[model samples]
Target: MRPDDLHRYITERMRMSHVYQPVMLRELLKSDGEATVEQIAKALLSHDRSQVEYYEIRTKNMVGKVLTNNGVAAPVKDGNRIVGYRLTGFGDVDAEVRDRLIAECEEKIADYIERRGGNIWQHRFNAKGYVPGSVRYAVFKRAKYRCELCGASAEDVALHVDHIIPRNRGGQDDLSNFQALCITCNTNKRDQDDADFRGVADSYGHREAGCIFCEVPADRVIAENELCYAIRDGFPVTPLHTLVIPKRHVSDYFDLFQPELNAIRRMLDELRSSIQDEEPNVSGFNVGVNAGASAGQTIFHCHLHLIPRRDGDVPNPRGGVRGVIPAKQSY
Candidate 1:
């Protein structure tokens, strides 16, 4: 066949295979000279049977015959049975054919992205790394060595400087973006990827100039003077829950100093007391804070959740932020 005809046939066959275009092209180039259909399939599909079947049909149609070594088709030996086929010297030539196929595929992909009005790099942002010492010092100063959420003092409490808006969401490596979080709250909101809650720190002036928390008729809030702010727990395993937040907006427990930590502790005490008085049958509490989306902090503003727990809350409350969170594990 003419090289142009072979290229076109190879391209059409590859399109029908449903293999990942870029990955297949890379494998073809990487082989340097030759590769088996079995080797190619193993590289592409790994253990996926659907993928193997798709490639098998495509390869047969394109190449006219199964690849072989010494007149025997390469086959996966499962006990005494031949389960799969391998490629031959002819298959190596086919790899070159696949390369031309990929160029066409890339053009199609580029056209698709252009039609959709998507910039290739529009999603990427500046990812400036943080200075650890500065971050630690900033946390200590922000919280005044207190737990911002629970108001635990630094004397016995562990503190962390948490990002109010997580780093993943274009949060800058600056002091204002950090908050003092306690061990409990820090563990809760660790590396959270949620963008809605963790709005860009610089974009706050543009987006949240109006406070969504309270209905005060003010353009800007001088202070959010309440100890415990109410927030929703999106993936609640428990029913009837709310979070407590400090009046001041801070990210983590470590961001709070002595006074702020004291305030948080006082708030928790009051909440616990109130719950005991109002709901006498209240069995326990599932208090938490998420630092980042990965850790499960959905909101950027500093807050503590007071989740009411009853018997049989969940079969396994051992997953999510609760399971692997590195808090005071005893509590």
Candidate 2:
């Protein structure tokens, strides 16, 4: 379009969902009517004050704390807001010395980036790499544009779509496997919680060659996720009874990790819905786990029973699982 048309559209007719249209156009205009996606993205990022606020918090709480503790620099705060930082001894030094120190700092940053390469940003990109914009929008929408972990509004803090079970720990890319967290909460969870997922990913592959659950045939798996699977019980306690099992060979439920529990829970909910759909008479479910042989756990490998309960399945079902102990079934 001509300049008059473009200007008219921008001034009068441009309907905006966000600042993106103007920002992208500005970038393209600055580059002679052409700009890379990266350039547009960087320009858009400059308008994101939430990300800037996140880094400001990091500067004040982490880097500033360290520098101040070591007597190297201090924060320049406007009331409670930290606007910038000042080097401790730089003001007293000669101009040449100050320039030399600044150069040294630049050299340190360059050397670290050269040594670490892109690994320095691994935490941001994570093992799953870039999440598509649509998927990120879905996650944020699911969270109602709030942090799932801390309930921080998207307007107040930068929110991230995080894996409920980290991909490095064998977490999958299922919609059920993601959560929304604000920048502050996400950083604390990843850094301060000792997120040492080094061997956890590989550990999900552990299996005993002879274990029934571990060696369960592919045909038997009715449903599966990254860390667990479900199958029809060979010996059904109820018509549509099922077994939710961890892929890893662990002795019992007590040995399962948080991610394993999450996977199992997802499988249980899915199977429950499927069973109810298939069997209209199914009134409820009995979820049980026998942890040891003494507790009637003969399989050894960790598995949970998802028994579909129908009305009148038994003469006295009021006691439910209390039937585990015959005498205690009454109350």
Candidate 3:
């Protein structure tokens, strides 16, 4: 299917479900008609250098999935080199895509009002230090006429002044509470609290394109013990594919202590029990882990996949995890 067709399907499905990759690849492309993973990361992460690579890899992967032409979406290559990413047919965006973004905007507006309305109006609505003209301009100048989120410029994109503390979080309309953010980032920050607004922008809600394996959001969490937690996969190969993760942010599977391992194991059982109780059609299972980069680990965080499988989900399921190695799958 064309990218436009895919977008229509996505927008319709999103009404009843929560999806993370609601952005189209073309929406993020620069005027040069392509964007590197790192460039795209800055657009999403803004100035957060602490977790660039984690968001970068996921953005790179999402390019292949969401940006398609004739049902094929992959990176644009220049003879054994990946130059960047792009999507085809860019006159006017599909109405579905536009509607999806609008819906996202509306949801965020409501969330912001619900969370910050009373407190912000009480303090900064008509309060004295509500900086607007010259002072707000200084914040933009300090950020170099660029969006503090998404890295958009005054040339290509309009910017907005955002409260770092936010109205609900004791933020006033004064200079101290303000920062320069693109409208996209400001809207995406709606579902997030003050502390996590920037951190989880690319991992949760509609605009996300980050390493969900390592950066699982609290909302996706299903069950947890003292040491381990179970989170539903953001992009699951199968329904109810859940990950049992260690609470302490260790990367390697072997790095997990016995207590962490035991906690994960127990959570696995709890997840399986709940799946059996809830989804009776789910049959069989695929339990596995990807250890390192070469071993297929994408996020660098130790996570165990407990994927539920049904009888006829695939044409053949003899090889199971050995499907990871297509050449040696027969035996």
Candidate 4:
């Protein structure tokens, strides 16, 4: 195409879902109509405000606080946000002295990188080096484009495909091994991969022969995590009713562990998303747990009911879970 054709296409015919097309074109133009994929990607990364926001949080909460407390530097705040840092006594230095100081900083960075080697970036890159884009999309989809760790939406922050178990600790590159985590949660969890979870793993093995949920067949399980499995209710109150049960035979909901609770919540969210996709009319859900005999618990094993609700499913759906009592359902 000639210059006029290119100009016409850019100004008139360019349809943009994001800023990517123009950014890539600008990069190519800057590089004399050619640029490596890496160069273009780096150029794109420069425009990602979320990444800068992620580092801003790190500066304010972690490194900046440390420096400020040590009397080495202070935070430059733009309202409540830490926009940058100002070094102590640095403003007093001339251009030459500042250059020497910058060189000293560079030397320190180089020495640290040399000493640590690739281990410095071990938190970001695992044994496999990178997760396939398809696998990442699947993980993100399963998590409903929200961080599984902190429940942050993808629009609110940058999400990462993180290993539930770190690769250094023998985590696999399987679909089931990956989870969607926001940048903040991922960074907070990075160095804490060494936390011992052997006892938690062992707890999932606790089961009683008589408990129906404890012995739920593999065939019945629709979705599961390490601590919980979800199955379609045998006698459903609604069409897409689900039972999210803990692996361990814990009779009381109060007796369930935190990890087990997290697993159950994740399974519930996954099932809800599936139901919504499969049944477009699904407007809401009813989550219930019958604790003891008085609360109408039939099985000894703890199981949560996830019942999908639709418009006009009931004559009047004013008080949802309160409908269990029937009398107080109206008010």
- Model 4, residue pairs in steric clash: none
lDDT of 4 at 240: 72
Model 1 lDDT per residue over 1-331, tens place: 5657657656775565444664565576689645677767667766454344444544443333434424535555589855566644334456667888688989998898888764554422222334488667856875689877788787755565666656666655555456776655664454333446444333333323443442323433222322333343444444445445554555565565333454565556566776677677778886766676567654555566666666655544556334222232111
True-structure RMSD, every candidate: 22.0, 5.8, 26.1, 6.8
Better of 1 and 4 by lDDT: 4
Write model 2 residue lDDT over 169-196, tens digit each, in one string: 7667876567788988876776566655
Per-residue lDDT over 67-107 for candidate 3, one digit per residue giving the tens place of the 0 to 100 score: 55345445678998665666454458989998997899899
Segments in model 2 whose C-alpha atoms lie over 4 Å from true places: 1-8, 26-39, 57-66, 75-84, 92-128, 132-148, 153-156, 163-179, 199-221, 233-238, 248-256, 272-331
lDDT of 1 at 294: 67
TM-score computed on alpha carbons, candidate 4: 0.65
Ranking by lDDT: 2, 4, 3, 1
Off by over 4 Å in 4: 78-81, 126-139, 147-152, 162-179, 188-202, 207-225, 228-244, 254-289, 304-331
Off by over 4 Å in 1: 1-211, 214-239, 317-331
CA shift of 115, model 2, Å? 7.0
Alpha carbon lDDT of each predicted model: 0.54, 0.79, 0.62, 0.78
